[model samples]
Target: MMLLRYLSQIGKYFLMWKEIFNKQTKWPVMKNLIYKEIDDLIIGSLGIVAFISFFVGGVVSIQTALNLNNPLIPKYLIGFATRQSVILEFAPTFISIIMAGKMGSFITSSIGTMRVTEQIDALEVMGVNSLNYLVFPKIIALLLYPFLIGISMFLGILGGWMAAVYGGFTSSIEFINGAQMEFNPFHITYAFIKTLIFAMLLATIPSFHGYYMKGGALEVGKASTVSFVWTSVTIILINYIITHMLLGS
Candidate 1:
């Protein structure tokens, strides 16, 4: 009986997602929600992403160089490996993980706070479709965040190049050549698509959990923690699925 009830609830939530996408009801107030989420994701994440990406590139370059000693492995393969790893895997995956920590926690806490404070209730009383007004904007904002992170990832590659040259892992020209040789437009596209899907799940799931939070302040904290854990797990699982299904490697 309990399992049946749980299945029924899942069905209802699925329908809610369908309804949201279908625009069965108007939700003009999603604009503010979108902006709020953008501020939290894009604007708020800038500094941390910049710092992390720069170091990540540097570390990856250094490590890759340390691992290769065979003449059979061309020195330029470092660049190829770096480019592929950064674009298709490291950049997108790591950035999403960071975002799950930063933006995910923010969404959970904010929404949970609103729930605890009755602000969500107030919005309800005002005839706002809380889901549409709150959730939609966040979803849109997170979708955009991944593209920004993609750009950041590119810059990070450049940072890695600089670090590699300075650290004597590879010459500047060799690094650039490796990157160019490995460049694949399809891989870049795949990364972007994956990031977008990740962003959607990252934003929506946390916000959903937070929005319905009950109890009190402590419960809000719990929701935030759960949001981070679930978002990270979902991101990793989804990334594997997409990588195998779409990229076929």
Candidate 2:
């Protein structure tokens, strides 16, 4: 039964993607979904991303500075490392994890609550496709989140540079120079791609768990827990796959 449920969830995910592509069939639904997702990304997620990025940038800079005692290590390399870390790993992975905790739980609980309350049944009676209506918006919103997160990460890198300079870890000139040196555009673009994939998984998995929720409040709680755990685990696993395939060890 458990295995079947998992497989069924996977099937639902594919169906959701198919709906996204078949625009003529789902145009009105897609429009609504896109709006909902935009709200989730822009209004709901913006503050948290900003907060996390700022601290992560500062902490990473400090740690990197502490580890580098040798004069051979360029001072500006700290900034470079900060940028690379924020752009490549921190922004995408951390944001996904945070969203898994926040948005994922919301998706699970909202859907589960609707099921427990029989609102989902009302939607079915009204001829509304619950999956397309409820789930698709979340998926679309998450697709936009990573780009916003990428912007947050860029700001965080600037914050880190400011912090490092304040702490005398590196001069302002050296920090700027090192950051510009050896910079590659592919790094940022690749991170965005990885983020898009992660966001989809993060958004969809929780919605899938919540959509089929049975029982009452306790079951709703269980679904929320499962959503968080599974989404976080999946994000980590996918991160590894993308990193190994693209960045490589």
Candidate 3:
């Protein structure tokens, strides 16, 4: 029964997805909406992402330096590990999980509130495809998500470098060598791919929860929480699948 219910929900979600591109909102209106969404979703998120990436990257560096207490081990490994950790997982995957809380909750609650207040119904009555008007802009705005993740990668490496140098863990020169050593360009590609997929999940999953939620004002809050959970879980699952496919040998 539960499985059947889940299957039904999945079907409904896809139906909404299909409708998002139909009965398109006019470009003039949609242009403004898209800009608003980009400001709300992408530009609004930069400060937090940058701050977290910087500190977390530093922490990763510090931890790696502490662990390599052996004279036999090269100090450069600290930089190498920090670079790998930040690029491969921390910047792309972990930061995305964080956004699943921040952005996901906002999307869900905003939409759920609209539902509760009958604003969505009013849109339908006015002949607007609310789904397309609401969700498509978010989807389009989040196409810039990879750019955000790219900034995260750069900040993370920069943070790691600063932490290692200032903490007396390694000389800047040695750390640079390690970071530059055997660098695979593919890792960046992999991270961006994961980021792009996660971006879609972040946009859609929370919108789903908000759009379809039933009940009154209280349900909006509940829907937001649920959306965050589902969004985060989906991101982690997809991260695993993408990693397995792309990096697993």
TM-score of 1: 0.90
Candidate 3 clashing pairs? none
Segments of candidate 3 deviating more than 4 angstroms: none
Per-residue CA lDDT of model 3 for 1-249, tens digit only, reads 999998998899999999999999999999999999999999999999999999999999999999999999999998899999999999999999999999999999999999999999999999999999999999999999999999999999999999999999999998999999899999999999999999999999999999999999999999999999888888988998999999996
TM-score, ranked from best to worst: 3, 1, 2
Per-model lDDT: 0.80, 0.82, 0.95
Q: Count the backbone clashes (under 3 Å) in each candidate.
A: 0, 1, 0
| Quality of model 3 by C-alpha lDDT | 0.95
- 1-249 per-residue lDDT for model 1 (tens digits): 999975774585566566456432254456665677788788888888888888888778878888887767767766777787788888889888888888888888988999999998997798766777677777778767766777777777877787788888778888888888947799888888888888887778788778767899999989999889878988999999999998785
- Residues forming the 10-long window of minimal summed lDDT in candidate 1: 19-28
Cα distance off (Å), candidate 1, residue 160 = 1.5
Error of 3 at 215 (Å): 0.9
- Model 3: C-alpha RMSD to truth? 0.7
